[model samples]
Each structure stands twice: as structure tokens, then as C-alpha cells.
Target chain A: MTDATATRPSIAGEQRIDGSDLLGDVEFLVARVRAIGSGHAREALAPFGLRVRAYAVLSLACGSVSPTQRDIADFLQLDPSQVVAVIDSLEASGFVRRAQHPRDRRVNIVEATEQGLATYAEAREAVSRARDRSLGSLSAEERETLTSLLLKVAF
Target chain B: MTDATATRPSIAGEQRIDGSDLLGDVEFLVARVRAIGSGHAREALAPFGLRVRAYAVLSLACGSVSPTQRDIADFLQLDPSQVVAVIDSLEASGFVRRAQHPRDRRVNIVEATEQGLATYAEAREAVSRARDRSLGSLSAEERETLTSLLLKVAF
Candidate 1:
């Protein structure tokens, strides 16, 4: 058999010239990690019929506040049309429903059904496991610090 | 006048229940940071006739190694077809060209032209400025720490 691994081009190897080049860039690193994490999440969520985007919408809906479509769009940084499509899919599956916001009647709220909550709880566990596996190289403290740093830049 | 900012639903406000939740998840944080960074990069690269994805491909092409389409796809975690499209656009714009890989006759390498290199140099500076502005809230030390942590996870 050919040495398959030997022939594989390593990104780190290719980009490690000065150790402070494009690969070390914050935006590039964030995109890389997100891509890897999303890949794992996508596979883990497949059994639940959820993609990352839909799962994000579902997760937000399962939160304490009932989010409107606009809320989901704004929070997720997704377009309103994209949020609507995800919500439509979730609504079709009976995982979520559109209800009037008690405090704001003009806004339609995305509320999770009991089934949705149950599904989300299970999906959350799967996603968490996948995320942890992806970050297995980092310790708990490192992960905590990474999260804090990311929040500072992200928000 | 309408208070447009007030009408916007804040992502932080929507998810600040216990100070830690799904929004605080590492994967979610990575995704959020990537989104924000990409938004900034998109605006900065627009004048250069590049989007974030194309810029990534260009950056890789401008690197020390003459990367193959497969290498670009693998390193960038983009689909091969997507990389092909980006390369096509870059090629058409005269920023890049397909050349024969000396070591591997079967592989076509994506190499930057003189014009491409010059354009990439300018684009890199613009992107760096945009990245720095987006990360202005963080101290230089914090940014360095974040970059180190991200490199560990990303690679």
C-alpha cells in the first residue's frame, strides 16, 4: 500500500515558515476551527435531521426567551430569509411553533414544543460531546481561557 | 426619528441568562467570531475585488508552497468545487494561474503571478488593518494569547 498519510499535504507544515503568518491570523484561525467544529456537529446532528444552522435556531428557540424570526436572524447573524426557512422546517416537523409574543403582540415568537425541547436536550448532549472531542487537545482551563478571549473579540 | 439601534435585538441580551449557556459554547463562540470577522473582512476586501473565501485561496496561493487545488481545498476546509470556482475567478482576474507541479506531473499547481503577488501584498495589508480594527477591544497581549490558543485548536 502507498503511504497515504505521507502524501497528504499538511496545512501546518505548509504554513509554518515564520509561525506568525497568514495561518496564525485570528480570522483565519477562527474560520478554520469553526469549519472543523461545524463538520463534527453536522455529523452528530445528522440523526436528528438537523444541520448546524437549523440547530442554532433550535437552540435559540429552546432558550428562556421566545425568539422571533427577526430575533433569530439578528442573534445568529443570519439573514431573515434564511431564519424563516429554518423556522419553517422546524415548524413543519412540529418541533417549533409560531406564537404571539405575550409582551409584544406584533412580533411572532418562535417557541419550542415539548417534543422540540426533548429533541434539543438530546441534540445538545450530542453536540457537546462532538465539540469536546474536537477540542480534546485542550485542557478545561485552556478551553475556558479560549472562550473568554473569543468572547472579548466576538461581542 | 426612529431609534433604529433600539429596535435591534441584541444577541448578548438574548442569551445572558446564567452568564454561561449554549452561546458560551466554544464551537458557538468560534462560529460567532468567524461571522463577525468575515463581515469585517468582506467589507475591507470588496475594493480589492475579493471576498473572504477568495482571499483565503489567494493567501494560500501566495504562500511559499505552490498549492494544488486539492491542497487549497484541504487546508481551507472548503469543497474542492468551491476552491475550483474561486481559483477560476482569481485566474480570470489575472491574480493567479495554473502551472504544472514539478514534483507531481499529475497535479496542477496554483501559483501567483507578479501582479497577483502585488495585489495580494496590498490586500493582506488591508485585511490586517480590518482584522486589527475588529479586534481593537482586546489588548495586544490578549490578542497574542487568543491567536496562540486558536492556533492550537485550529491546527
Candidate 2:
């Protein structure tokens, strides 16, 4: 079945009949690209038994510092309950564990296990490949520019 | 309560300890900024009884072309069922209506009601202001660059 081609803008300026109005909107563009990228990452990480969110948690855990659940929630912009759930799943898979903070006994820090690091190494490669494929249209310079611009808004 | 400072990078060059590793990852940055921007839009759009996704739908509906349900789904990268649900809500709220396509009887096009267009105009202003607030850190030129880069990836 033929889909609606009415929405596609023509170069000749022949009375545009489409949702091209949304094309210039930053939020819409961001959400669209993110959804597409996330879908690709999810598919790529599926063989590793990891979703994008879980992979994000694992990636953060592989960082230099052992992040607490609260830190994960804040950095990932996830709810505390959601962070707890991802951590719980990661712990069950032996990817991460909650331990008492080195300086603060009252708090728990999430640290990656050896297996977790190894798994992350593989998953990171897969995720990177997936990202590269998703952003294959852009040049290296464009990608770098995109990243730098995103950081200004993101952080 | 003192949150875990472990994840915060030290400024003294004493070995940066944080998820700085994921900072360069485009997908992560996109997700982060999108989350922050969406949150701001959500709050600003609340008074109009719209969320980001719904606002997107309404914005599309307000465009020059009356988009079909399939068109909306394809353009938004949303599930057809989800589009149907959103359309149902908007239709019930008198914001939009499903009409038989002038060119194709079998196709139903989604068009904004007068109320929908009026509401959309106000919501667009709110959403734009919210986006400006969320992206306050960037210069106007940077915002344009960000939007252009996002469009390249999104389209």
C-alpha cells in the first residue's frame, strides 16, 4: 500500500502539504533521533541481555567512581524507584552490587563486578557499533559538533 | 542527607571520578538533553493539559496539511495504536477530528478543530518558551546549530 506522500516537502515550493512544520522544532527532532537511536541500541544490546537503560547503568558502574543509586537516578534523569529496579536486575545478573560507601556507611554505592566490567566491554563495543550505524549519515566532524552542542544543553 | 559525592568529578585534577566516560557518547547525551528538555516542556505545557507527545501531535495537526493517522504515526515514529489513542483523546477534547480524506475515501485524515488550532498556538508559545528556558545556557547561534545538527540526524 502506498503511504501518504503528501507530507514530504518538495524543493520547488509547490504549496507544502505536510508536517514539515515540526521539522524545525528542536524538541521534536531530539525526541525522534533519540527514539531511533535507542531502538537501534536496544536491538544491538539484546544479545547481551541488556536494554539501553541497563547498559547505561552498567556503563556508569564501569566508571572510575562507584555511583550510588541516587547518583544514578540524578545523572540518568530516572526516578529513584526506577534506578533501584535497574540496580536490582544488574545485581541479580552479577553485573553490579550495592556496597556500603567507603566513607559513608549510611549510603550504598553501586560498583561493577569483574564480570560486569567484562560484559560492559563487550556491550560497549556493541552499543558503539550500533550508534555508529545509527549515525552513519553524519561525518566525523559533524558527529563531534553534534556531541559538543548536546553537551552544552545536556549538562 | 549528603548524597554520594563519589560520582562527582574532582576539580583538582585528582583523577576525575564520574561517568565522564559516557559524556562523549552521542546517544547518552541526546537522551540526557531530551529528558531535561521534555521535563521543562511538560511543566510548561501542563496548564494547557498537554504533554510533549500530545503537544507534538497537536502541533502536527495544526500544520498546513491535514495528516492521516498513518502519516502521524510514521512522522512521529509512534505505534499506530498509540496514535489512535492520542487522536481519540484529542478528538474527545474537541481539539481534533478524523475526517474522510478528500482524495481517498478509505483514508481518514486528522485535522485540528478551530479550538485545536487556537489551543495549539498557545501551547506552541508555551513549549517554545519552555525550550528556551531549558536551553538557556546556549547562545542563539548555538541553539540554531543544535537544531540543525539534530535535524540532520532526525530526518
> Which digits, one per residue and each the tens of the lDDT, describe model 1 over residues B31-140?
99888898899999999999888888888788887777887777787789898899999999999999876555776688889988999899999999999888998999
Task: Report the C-alpha lDDT of model 2 over A1-155, residue by residue, as the tens digit.
Answer: 14454454322222334665578888888889999899999999999899899999999888887777767888898999999899999999999999876555666678899999999999998989999988988999999999998988888
Q: List runs of model 2 lying over 4 Å from the truth.
A: A1-17, B1-17
Residue A32, candidate 1: Cα error in Å is: 0.7
Query: How close is chain B to the truth by TM-score, in each candidate?
Result: 0.85, 0.88
Which model scores highest in TM-score? 2
- The per-candidate count of clashes, in order, stands at 0, 0
Query: What is the lDDT for A69 in model 1?
Result: 81
**lDDT per prediction?**
0.82, 0.83
Question: lDDT at B124 for candidate 1?
Answer: 91
